[model samples]
Target: MTVPFYMCCQYVDGKFCFVLHEWCAKLPLKVQHHVVHPAHTFFLLPKIPSKFFGVFNCNICKLPSNGFAYGCTMCGIYVDINCAFIPKEITHDAHPNHLLSKVKPLVKLTKRNCKACNYPMRFRWGYDCTSCDFYIHLDCALFLPRVTKHKCDEHTLSLRYEPAENHISEYFCEVCEDEFSPWKWFYHCTRCAQSMHTTCVPLILQCEKSRMTYDSGGVYNFLNVKFGGTLEIKGHSHHLTFVQGLESDGRCIKRRYVLELSMIFKCLEFALMDQIDHFDHHHPPSLVHLQQPSNKSEEDDDEDEEKDEDADNFVEEEHHGGKCNMCNEQIWSFHLSYYHCESCL
Candidate 1:
């Protein structure tokens, strides 16, 4: 990762000169600063490394770059690089009917406040726009529901800007499996009067992706929670099943999902470990095992004793060991299970 450049000021030719610096290595050079009047803005002059100079005013902040320069992509709207990568879209449950878009300068559009959030889409990066004009904060936009499904519920829930008089007022989320008020952004089962929290929807979407490998009925919801049922994708022979489980009511389904995600992570961990082992042949297996995830639970009664023994074994084994090809740590066993530190790896 590159360290951020900083702005600095120095007195030169009886005047304070602004400049961009690498944040370290004190160096200053004299140069002309770009100052756009009418706009009353200041900018750094473009120069190659060979002709580099010191302190210059940042055209964006009206202050020095603390010694570094940042180029803005938005047509001369320069800002520090740190502030450049804002999210473009957000779908918030607070305003279900709309997906929010960030405000863009130089674009003319009528602004409207969110009926649900009472937040103006024109202000603070939130604005309501038609095909003609659109703007809203990224977080505010997330409230809209992109899709709906029924699972262990009754009334059908659809994403709407406002609720109807006869609409079901409360239901449980099939994803988090939690009960919530229907007024909130949620998944509603029209048949059973069921609903799901807005936050639960994204997690449920992940389960859908993973379901592609399983067949209907073959993938059980352990907790007897109902689903929208299985799906048969085009170009595939097998059916896929998924269950949205709310906590408190769908314990079995929750556990199944957790187990599945944990297994996936474990597989990734092993792949990483294998790569490390191949690169460092001389590292002892025991040291590598220390870096690997523990199969035994932390609550195991023997954990403390095992840890003490392992430490003792490591020290003794290193007493007359060959140097590790990676870290300087002593080799403990010939079955090298080298674990790479995240930074080094």
Candidate 2:
């Protein structure tokens, strides 16, 4: 049998025990030695294909793992390679004074949320400062990148760890169109007025290379063809031309229509419009308008607003009379009404 060069193991009492190679020597000493978690002596263990173990989830992040892990056989405690090397302490721009200590929430009485991102930390491992009620996710504490570029936008985006203190309303990601807490980290392009969630930024930069494979699903080919370009679909007769943000009739398409089309044809190679040339044709092909229908009434809008207000009130009542779940700040009457500290809500 030929053994993979990247894998190394030892025969311990008749059973195979995985061991870290020289590549793992570059990892932090704490993780390598298991000094922080004495009960669980960490070892590099690769995922086994057998059904005996069932599914293994990381104790720290609570996310399922099927890759290289640092684990202990005796206690059955395991953590993914990324979580194993998380720093013990971190200082974020949002909370600079006290070093946020990496900790697992011991109490389950109150719902805990990260102060930096305003995201719930019920089962995830994150950094916290008891003194200031400051908490943040391990990924957020690392401050992944300072700047990034995405194909969705023209200008480069700069990381904004926290919004300005004076700024009030919530911010929404331009790409996903989902609202994100202003207190959390995000990417912003000042010139283009584009803002995206830190999590969403990575998806924009994913490799555009097509995955070529033959399967029963008719030989899927993920194409990265650009707009206004011609591409051949499997069964389509005419070469499909990509046209975005506009109808074939030259009228501006609605934003919602573009978003809907993008979602529906995300992985498919069919074009939104088709252009064909025929010698016998007497006149040019009539352009089709790609307009989205909107029939929302004023009463419906008002009802929606009322429902949102009611939900906000209910949340406030649930967390009222207690400290802010995120920052640990005293939840005054006014603060309780908002369900967050002045810095974040």
Could you estimate the TM-score for every candidate?
0.26, 0.46
Write the residue-wise lDDT of candidate 2 on 215-262 in tens digits.
Answer: 101111111112343456576567655432211122223333322112
lDDT score for residue 258 of model 2: 26
List, residue by residue over 1-345, the lDDT tens digit for candidate 1.
256565456676665554444643232222123222224232332321221132233332222232233332233433332222334455555444775555542223334543433334343333344553434433334324455554434444665334434766545456544454444334445555444444444343433322221111111112112233355556645554433332212123324443332111111112322432332335533334533355786578465566765553453433334344444657554433544333333
The global C-alpha lDDT for each of the candidates, from Candidate 1 onward, is 0.38, 0.52
Worst 10 residues of 2 by lDDT: 212-221
In candidate 2, stretches whose alpha carbon ends up further than 4 angstroms from where it belongs are 1-37, 48-56, 73-75, 108-111, 164-167, 205-345
lDDT of 2 at 85: 75
Model 1, position 209: C-alpha lDDT score: 26
Give the Cα RMSD of candidate 1: 22.8
Most TM-score-accurate candidate: 2
